[model samples]
Target chain A: MEGFLNQLPIGLSIGAVLLLIALGLTFTFGQMGVINMAHGEFIMAGAYTAFLLQDWAGRSAVLVALPVAFVVAGLMGLLLERSVVRFFYGRPLDTLLLTWGVSLVLQQLARDLFGAPNVQVLSPEWLQGAVGPLPYNRLFIMVLAVGSVVAIWAYMNRSAQGRRMQAVMQNRQLAATSGINTGRVDQRTFFIGSGLAGIAGVGLTLIGPVGPTLGTYYIVDAFLVVVAGGLGQLRGAVIAAVALGLLNSYAEFWTNASLAKVIVFAVIIAFLQFRPQGLFVLRSRALT
Target chain B: MLSVDGLEAGYGRARVLFGVSLAVTEGQLVCVMGRNGVGKTTLLNTIMGVLPATGGTVTFEGRDVTRLKPHERVKLGMGYVPQGHETFPQLSVLGNLLVTLEASGNPQSALDDALEVFPRLKPLLKRRAGFLSGGQQQQLAIARALVTKPKLLILDEPTEGIQPSIILEIEEAIERLHASGIAVLLVEQYLDLALRLADRYVILDAGQVVHAGTAADLQGEEARRLLAV
Candidate 1:
């Protein structure tokens, strides 16, 4: 019972991190239906931004890095959308290949810049302590994850621009006829999606090393979360992230880590076979 | 308020409209009537810039708007309600109206004005539009467009697949819109409704406007003869 209780916080922490990473993937992959393999790199870029900032400014670097990484990653996403992803809308295979190539290019760029070495991000004294059984850093990430989800949910539900995105997601032709600049919506979606991933990168550094390939490992897991969640549904992403994160944590506690991943994939595949549309079914008249 | 001269447009290689020209004056209700697949919707789409014009020009309020995007045209006071009354199904009725209001840069006031115009929508503001009956959805769609306070409203087949009682309601709403002096370019298949509302008429046959005349000229045999595929 004590062992189980001890593992619970770590499971919850893992779930929170998964939620943060998958939030951005939900927008890019689930809502827009774009295959952004390079999303993981955005997370890496955020982490590297934090690393660089910490090297430049010691104690306050972590605080400053959060916003800076968001902008950096968001701008990168916007650039990718304009230069490449925009041209490949509705062509999933092309987007997949293009973003995969982008991932490789970003990986190479990071390796060249940072010399393939994993950098340590020294957490501030404020974040060094623990809350009961939970590490303060882990608790901080969990809070951020919840905060981000709330912020995104409120924006999507209340804001006019967010409603326009919902309209575009439902029907592009109808949205255009209704006077929404669909292109601008697409741009903003990319920025927000990538920006969230950048923030997730900050969370990632709390638990582990910040390295060039940090995003690559999480990218596949994030994709799994999106697929296991219902496409175009935010609630599904949250549910799926927590469920999968806990399941993976429990499985890894009992078995080998590699086998745990294989088990997770198996469970997701089996789950999908039963419920193809996923946990939440989006309601929209398919565009003609 | 709107003029299309020698407009040509198509979907990829399959040409759908050829040299279709018409005029809609201020506060006038101009109906484009045709049988199924005769490019009535295509003409509207071209005018709204959903489909690119392959040839000719579209003038809206004396400016050549042929090359403007669909959203830009809407910003310029041209409102379009496409075929099928494509409401955002997931959103509530109010959400649908708010979309256009937000896009038009007028939110709260536009909502109040739209609700005042279509008071039936006020009670159902919180209801998801997909669950609404076809009539209600159509009303929401039109109300969504009207929230923008567009100078010119273009509707394609507004009465399609709707119940007769609701159809009558839509017709009455059209009358009110006309009375308000908003220029309306309506594409409708219902002969009685078109004749009842339109001051001027254009008949399209196989992607071309075959006849253009006053509504009185299209009263009886000429209407059936031109409309018959």
Candidate 2:
């Protein structure tokens, strides 16, 4: 492969990871008009579930762990909605404060259970194998990321339930008046959101070890993408993810990875300053 | 048929609609007119179950619907085109229509009927509803409400933001719906337009019905003064 073309899959792979994570957060924060600071906790919850399962069973357990994480995170989201997030919805500052507090509590609880150190999971042998022509490259991770995007894209765009979800996301009032049970929609969307996070955590486990403090680090970065993508926009998640992924990769190629993230965060802030509505403003009527 | 009696509703503690009562027969066009802040919109919203009524009885086709959820009311043959025609802007005009069809038990909604009523929607079906002009959106909004083939159609200011000619088209569409035996309950600011099409008119002031009579009674000078801004 040509030099630039050879790097395309890597860029696309990073984009997929960003896309998956961003997609999950979009529903919790974007469509439902939530400021879920604990979204990363859901991701961590997924990772932890996978980690625990990996220790008990063989490597193929990671696949089973994916669904288990989805259920765990989704149940947590439902509980959060019923308990905490519902009260402060539409009050962004209060929600931010609440979720920030929740992140700490969740992290401390995880530390108590799993210890403060990182816990690793072995990738399955099937997923462990690579298909790219290069001996030095491990590109199966790239395929997994792209595959997730395609699956999510199909679910969100083609199915009746998916279309209804889009309806609720686009305009809650109109959708409700159209005889869609928006409360039901809200619950389902939140589940999908949290489940997506769980899946993303599984993806993260494929690349890196998960720690009790896992959620704390990625929460801010995901928030950056949500703000940059024009909150509530699914496509905006894709755009912002790709842009941030490419920018971060290229910046890291030149500068340090930590410095590149700072630049990306700074760029997101600047983007917000210019387009407060986000990159692609989804004309939404969130049930605030 | 539709009926609302002693419908008292509010936003928070501030009561908006006070003892508002009205009825609409099937196939009749009923218009609710009032000055701004008279709770005209609230009355419509209260009946549609968007805003819960503090005290009232709302019966649609002889069934009590006051306690039903907005979407439940919708499933029971109620279609609302709220003020500003709040359609999903991100979706296309086609999407706007398709979304409403979920309310109907019919496998496929009568799309041809909707397109026939609003020809402009045919070309604009592929276009995002928000990108269309205000008039076009208005037409699409009404057509969207009709897609479900509701027994009762409620429109809250269908003429607002629309041009005079398009307003006429909407009025004509209401007339056609009325002719088809669908009850139409409309709240409009334009007195002339309301009087022209309505079989009966109910005027609100401070959430109470200040006047209720035939459209012909509105032609007299006293009712004319009530509509004057």
- Each candidate structure's TM-score, on Cα atoms with residue i matched to residue i, is 0.96, 0.89
- TM-score of structure candidate 1: 0.96
Which pairs of residues collide in model 1? none
Relative to the true structure, how large is the alpha-carbon lDDT of every model? Answer: 0.87, 0.80
lDDT for each residue of candidate 1 in A1-288, tens digit (9 for 90 to 100): 776766777888788877888888777775567899999999999888888898787856767888998999999999999999988988888999999999999999999999898998887788887867888888888898899999988988999888988888887888898899999998999999899889889878878999989998888888888878877778998899889888888889889899999999999999999998788877644232
lDDT for each residue of candidate 2 in A1-288, tens digit (9 for 90 to 100):
365554555565666667777777877776777788888888899999988897687797677887898899989888887788777766878888898899889989999999988988888876654445321123544455566667767886666677778788777777888788888777887887888788777777877789987777677777777778877676787788878767877777668888988888788778788898888865533121
Q: Tens digit of lDDT per residue, candidate 1, span B1-229?
A: 8999999999999999989989999999999998989898889999999999999999999999999999999999998988887789889998999888988897588778777767888899999888887778888889888887899999998999999988998898888988999999999998889989999999999899988889998886877998876
True contacts kept of each: 0.72, 0.54
Candidate 2 vs. true structure, TM-score: 0.89
lDDT tens string, model 2, B15-134?
998898999987788999988888988888889888888998999989999999998898788888889857777777887777677545545637668789898789888888777777
- Over 4 Å off, model 2: A1-15, A55-57, A126-138, A246-261, A283-288
Instruction: Give every collision pair in model 2.
Output: A230-A278, A230-A279
